[model samples]
Target: MNFLKSSVGRKVLMAITGQLMVLFVVVHLLGNSTIFIGLINSYAEHLHSLGPFVWLFRLVLLAMVLIHAFFGIQVTLENRAATPQKYAVNRTLKVSLASSSMIWTGLTLVLFIVYHLCHFTARLTSDVASYAGQVPGDVYKMVLGSFQHGLISFVYVAAMCALCLHLYHGIQSFFQTMGWNNDTSLPLISCIGRALAVIFLLGYSSIPVFILTGILS
Candidate 1:
């Protein structure tokens, strides 16, 4: 009850869930990278074959996503309430656009996630047109086909940009939650967070780039 009642407790819960999702992203990137290795079809089919297990994994993933989003919204609302004159207090402030615009970018990401699920996890909105009705037969082709379209590719790149903004803050917050924010270690931690954020952006963006360049077509 105390944990549910306290802001710190909610933040700790969010940090734990966020870190778990980050770990999932690392594996998801590796799994998706098979498309670059010339084994796209096999990789796609492997994912497709998970059947009930895939749904179970998805359920867990959805739970984590909801928890993270809920706490994040709560925090943002509380911040707005606590600082009614935040803009007035800093009329000339020039924060990083991404940092100041987290809510907008975050909404974009949420939409991207929904579209992504509809495209892959649900197969409700297929990218069959780009593949010329090839049907992909596996994960690689489906994913590749989705990025082959110019509009879709741009969407992915934009989403990756938003993801970079989210990670830029999220990663450091995670470390701080684990009690690693000290003067001597702050710079090192910040560097590591930036490095990881850059790697993630590049990794996720590479798929769209590869498709757009005709490298995988």
Candidate 2:
């Protein structure tokens, strides 16, 4: 209870959950990349075959996301309250845009995630229904068909841009919050984080672009 009430505790919770979510993102991208190699259908089927475990995994991921978001907002608000006044010297010129807009980027990602679940996971949208076939588990077809739409592809690419920004800052913060970085190593860690973020952005954004352009059909 004391830990939950403390600001440091909240930051620690956010860091742990953020790292877990990052891992999930990497795994998800790798799984989705199977589309390029022509194995996405089988991969999707294998995930579905997990039956109850799939739901269990989803529930765990949902819990992590909620906890991460909650603590993230809490910490951001507390920081603002602590330093309500802007620095007259304006020393933040060195900060990256992503680091400065964490809250906004995070909120954008939350909205994107909800839309993504509805569009793909729940298959609630007509866009998905049109291509997923009578069987609900044809995830490959669903992904390919949905991305064929120019607007959907654009939205996905835009979301990936938001995700990249969020990730670049979040990864560096993760290391900092965990007390794993020192003066000598912080620069390297930051560079690695940014590299990972760019890689993820390009990898995910390419899927929609490839699909829409008939490169992956």
Candidate 3:
């Protein structure tokens, strides 16, 4: 209980959960990229075949999201309370915009995640009707049909931009919290983080863009 209340412990928890979420994003992007190869339906079917285990995985992910958000808010508020005044030197100016806006970005991501789950996973929109009469789990058609809408594709691209900014800060913060960053390696790690964030942004954003442009149809 004491550990849970400690600042360092909360940071550690955030780091661990953040890493798990990152891994999930990477794997999810890779799996969804099968759309480019015309195998997304197969991929979706394989995931559906997981049956009860998929719900178990989703429960674990939900727990991670909640815990991470709770601790993140607690830590951020604690930091602000501890300072109580602006930094004498305004050191935040030295950091990247993404690093400075972690709280806002995180909150935005929470909303985006909820919308994404409804749009893709729950298929709870009228848009799903267009893909009805297809195979039972024709996720590819659903995805394609959904993205064909200018507004939906625009929202997806905008959310991905937010994701990119969030990831750019998150990756470096994860390493620092884990005690893996050092003066000599910090620059390299930051660069790698930015690179990975861009890659993810492009990879995920391209699907919607391509669909909207009729390149992937």
Candidate 4:
């Protein structure tokens, strides 16, 4: 309890949660990537095969997102409150766009997450609801129908950009915060982190792009 109340502890919590979220993203991408191989329906079947446990899995996923987002907002606010007034012309010598705009990027991701849940999971909208019922339990066809649209795919790609920026800074800083990296290795870690972020961006963005371009259909 005491440790969690400390500044360093909060950062560590954020780092840990960030890693968990990253892992989830990677796993999710792999599952969603089944579309490329025509295994998406099988994948969805496996998930639905979980029976009542599907709800449990969803509850856990929801918990992960809430905990991560809660800590993220909390830490950002704390940092801003602790920071003193800065110079009129802040030096850009060491600052990067992702590092400087963590708050905004984070909030953007949060909003995207909510919309994504409603779009796919709940299938509340007319278009998505139509797809959900087009071929009962056909996750692939449903995904195909929804992503075939110009606007939906565009939003997905845009959201992925926000995710890329978040991971670029989040993953690099996570290593430093966890003491898993030293100043000498920081540059290399940053390079590796950037590569991973780009991979994720390309991997995820590819889906919607391919769908929109008639390549995946």
Candidate 5:
């Protein structure tokens, strides 16, 4: 209990959960990328074919998100308390935007996750039940229908931006926390994080951008 309560322990937990979520993000992007090759419906079908295991995996992801968010907010608060004036100084340092805004970006992602689930998974945000019926093209049609709207696509793109910024710092911190970086490796890790963030930003945002612009339709 003491170990878990310690700052180091909490940071270690954050790193673990963050890395797992990063893996999910990468895999999710790849999965989503199938749309470019016209196999998104099949991908969705494969996920659904997992039966109860799909929900089981979703539950696990949910748990991971909750844990990551909880510890993230806590650590941010602790950091702020430990250095009240640091943030004011950090504001002028453009390079530290991702690190300083971790809490805000993280909260944004939480809201996006809820709305995303409602939009795509639960289909509660629109009347797309017809496209989601027992048909092979159901998933693809539903996604296409949703992204056809300008507002929805904009929101998705914006959320991806937030996700990119969050991961930009989150990945770097993960390496630092896991003791995977020294001075010599820090630059390489930073580059890796930035590169991954850019890939995610482009990869995830492309779906909406292409659809909104009619390139994906």
Candidate 6:
């Protein structure tokens, strides 16, 4: 319990939670990529049938998300508090805008997450009624149909943009929290962070772009 009260403990918890969330994202991205293999429905049904334990997974994910967000906000607030007085000497902010401005990007991502849940997770959609008495095509059809609209595609692009920014800062932070930071290894970690961020953003963004171009039609 004493350890839990320590700053290092809180950071460790945050890192663990962040890694869990990243793993979930990786699995989700891999699952979504099945659309390219022409078995999106199979993948969707597999996910949809997680049964009662799905709720357990959701709860775990929720806990991780809230903890990570709370700790991030706490750290940002602490930084702000520490800088209550302006320094006489000119000094650049130690963090990047992507890192410092995470609260706004995070809020935008949360909205996107809620929108995604409404459209996919909760199986709610503008055309849900049309899917009545239908089989478990709930997930696939919604994603396919949403892309038919230019606005939805644009929303996806924007969300992916924010996500990439979040990941760019998050990946390296995770490494540092894990005690992996070193002069010899920091550059490599930084490179990996940028590469992963760019690749994920481009890969996810490609889906909406393809749809908007009528390639998926």
The clash count of every prediction, one per candidate, is: 1, 0, 0, 0, 0, 0
Per-residue CA lDDT of model 3 for 1-217, tens digit only, reads 8889999999999999999999999999999999999999888888878989998999999999999999989988988888757657876768788987888889888999998877677667788765544433788878888999999999989888888999999998899998998999999998999999999899999999999999999
- Alpha carbon deviation, residue 85, candidate 5 (Å): 3.1
- Model 5 spans with C-alpha error above 4 angstroms: 86-95, 127-137
lDDT of 4 by residue, 1-217 (tens): 8887887887887788788888989999999898899998888778778888988877877777787778778887887797776867756558899888877888888899899977777777666787554323777877888888899999989989989998899899999998999879999999989888888999999998999899998
The C-alpha local distance difference test score for the whole of candidate 2 amounts to: 0.89
Report the lDDT of model 5 for residue 6: 94
Q: lDDT by residue for model 2 over 1-217, one digit each (tens)? A: 8998987788888889888999999999999999899888888888888989998999999999899888888888888888747677877789789998899889889999999988887777888866444334667778888999999999989999999999999899999988999999999999999999999999999999999999988
lDDT of 2 at 79: 81
Better of 1 and 3 by TM-score: 3
Clashing pairs in 5: none
TM-score of each: 0.87, 0.94, 0.94, 0.91, 0.92, 0.89
Whole-model lDDT for model 1 versus the true structure?
0.79
**Model 1 alpha-carbon drift over 4 Å, by segment:** 86-95, 129-136
The better-scoring model by TM-score among 5 and 6 is: 5
**After TM-score superposition, what is the CA distance of residue 38 in candidate 5 from its true location, in Å?**
1.0
TM-score of 2: 0.94
lDDT value, residue 162 of candidate 2: 92
Location of the lowest summed lDDT over 10 successive residues in candidate 1:
128-137
Q: What is the C-alpha RMSD of each candidate to the true structure, in Å?
A: 2.9, 1.6, 1.8, 2.0, 2.3, 2.2
List the candidate 2 regions with Cα displacement exceeding 4 Å: 131-136
lDDT, each prediction: 0.79, 0.89, 0.89, 0.84, 0.87, 0.79
